[model samples]
Target: MEFTEPKAYTRSLIPFLDRSHSVAKPGFSRWLVPPAALCVHLCIGQAYAFSVFNLPMTRLIGVSQSAPGDWKLTELGWIFSIAMLFLGVSAAIFGRWVEEGGPRKAMFTAGILWAGGFMVSAIGIHLHQLWIIYFGYGVLGGCALGIGYISPVSTLMKWFPDRPGMATGMAIMGFGGGALIASPLSVWLMGKFASSTDVGVFNTFIVLGCAYFVFMMVGSMIVRVPAPGWKPEGYVPPATATKLITKNDVYVYDAIKTPQFWLIWTVLFLNTTAGIGVLGQASAMSQEMFPGHITPVAAAGLVGLMSLFNMGGRFSWASLSDFIGRKNTYFVYMCLGFALYITVPYAGGSGNVVLFVFCFLIIVSMYGGGFSTVPAYLKDMFGTRYVGAIHGILLTAWSAAGVAGPVLVNYIREYNVTHGVPKAQAYNTTMYIMAGLLVIGFIANFCVKAVDKRFHMKTDEDKDLGAARAPAGAAQAVPGRA
Candidate 1:
């Protein structure tokens, strides 16, 4: 409302603006940002590949005892969960910094802290200190998650204002695929460095920690946002595009006050919870349920396979959202996701591996799609002004889902284990619960109206002019990867 074309020149929240107030353009290339930023994403995606290291970390501590009774599964788990707690909380807390510091600064910070976390964990293993590993990995991993999650979406949207979903998807898809790379890497590193005699968990931890730290830093140098004032060549948002949220272009602060923010938050929370619940304990769940046939390692391989599904989903589903619109895509994911969850537990005595894999992969893609889609939705609803901040805030839902997902899967598995029911049957009960959450999400997605009419910023002149001056960065925003 304060923006005045005729009377005054003011700071604009548009992606690339300079001190002189001339519009900025993509400094280098928009499409280049995704591949460069994906380095950080792949590291954060290690969250999916967590189970690969859990066994080694646990054996270094809990399972090292001569007897089964000596170890506690609960203690070993605290490290990973503690890290995630920070991942969610830090994103919102540091989101402003992420925006101000520029993507390069943020990315470098993530690379150092995350890689250092591994080194710290390695030391903890060598010195036989469990708490140290918790502190080192927890805080550092949290930082990585915060930055990696935001970088590509923020940069991509700036470059590809018109197709925000596809741009974000291309970058985030790498994040989803991270576990695919990590699972194999973790396996190889563990095998190579593992002390043959004493369960050399310490040595393996050190080697891997160092390796990841070095690998992540390479990408940090390349990550950057576009120059100010860049828009795609020749294209402009129609008066139609401006009419939707133009007058209502609220600041991130103002957006939080609106109902739309909360509604979308709820949608993201449930979507993430449904996917993560299955993902966290997948291998263990698979082995426990199909103990006669599937080994934990094979089940873990299946989980890695799910990572491929997760990765592909981010790219394909989100790219599709650019065409179909985010709200509609979410409708499909949630409504279908609810049904998928319902089918999962009942996979039953049929011994159908194919059916199980198909169902799980669909769910994983939905989860990935939800993430890849939301930033564009944020751009649509909140305007680009505070979108990065708003999107960062929304990720708090992911943090919440992180806790909820594992708890739901593990608690049910534990309860069933205690009751002497097979873990597989117990998993069925959890799936039913997941179905209910997805139903709730589907309902929430239905509730998001176009940004309230009052918030629209399209003026008579803006309508007449109609994005004739869309910044130079627009061209960088290539279409969905066909």
Candidate 2:
């Protein structure tokens, strides 16, 4: 029997919380699909690494046509932040279309816009037209962020009901790696063509823009969702697994009213604020604090390594969470993150490269883990009826982090520089602030209770999410199907 989709009231977007988990199909293997999915994943993942572009992006603006706050940094930030900000907004706006279009279609559009954003940003950078950068990459990339992020996350979970943690990790890991890829690529291209020594910023922009456009297009064209009526081979949804909420009952408007979303939002915001501050300013921080010891290129490379940690943490650590449980994993992430923040500055100040690398990686991994573990967390709390939209909304926290991270890092750095505070001392103070924020995040994560009855669609069973947290069929899964 075909499962009937629930009708959400005034809900333009319907999340794919298919209740049947009946995934009662023939034999299928979840492992076979991730390689193709990874392509789409890495491209979307570019958002994670966009700060790599910020690498002297501020300098580029300073030299291009304007001064610091006048237009350059502001323009550049607008372009980048818009992508993140819009990801949440557009996901809320376009979620139903994603369900209708399926992963393949959603990813294709995502691929196009994502790559196109680079090409467009390249144009703005090349021509030294700041507004164009905002218009092209900002708006377009935002759309890509919304669609690309959602494309594989839920679908992969459904297909690999048995390994939701691992499957989702593989795809989201690419996002973590996107920065790793972009950092090296951007640096390479800059050195080859723009060469901070000679080519100036505009030429560097054109070259990297073309390269990213090409690289991203290759990924977008290849993305696909599993065939319908498919399930991971040997997968089985336990008889105890059931739905607490259905689509027809909850609307986005209805969702915001509940305490669950707000609490989750706090969890997301604090986690992101704690980690992203370092990520955004990693290269600059490294350079400023260790100016006598590390070269610009080495500082940049360290940023790339953090990206590797970011990417690896998503898949590696978060997959580990599946067995350990999401809450337990988060407890580790926030608590450890707090400790890491405490040490980062001392390591930077003492020029302890080894400690610096270790602390930094741990911090970045938690950043990635936060993203990877959240989907499962949401499924556990609010139910998946509006997961895509809920996930989208949760990411608004990322946008907020974008603002918070850059501002906190840069502001502190500026304050220090202006005051003649040693570069090393500047970030040390900020690290304390970040650590404090993370401590709050730790407490918040400890506080995340299941959704209250008011948030349930039709009944209180939603509050009793024991087996309801599961998805699709595992035992009946079929090869090449979801």
Highest TM-score, which number?
1
Q: Which stretches of candidate 2 lie over 4 Å from their true place?
A: 1-29, 47-77, 118-129, 183-231, 238-253, 287-291, 295-297, 345-351, 416-421, 458-482
**Candidate 1 backbone overlaps, count:** 24
| Candidate 2 local Cα displacement, residue 170, angstroms | 1.3
Q: Residue 6 in model 1: shift from native, Å?
A: 24
Instruction: Give lDDT tens digits, candidate 1, residues 103-124.
Output: 6556767877887787887787
lDDT of 2 by residue, 176-260 (tens): 7666666566677666665434334456555655555565455434444444555555666565533422222233445667776
Evaluated against the true structure, the overall lDDT of model 2 is: 0.66
What candidate 1 gets wrong by more than 4 Å, as runs, is 1-27, 58-73, 196-210, 242-249, 284-298, 349-352, 410-425, 453-482
RMSD (CA, angstroms), candidate 2: 7.2
Query: Model 1 scores what on Cα lDDT?
Result: 0.71
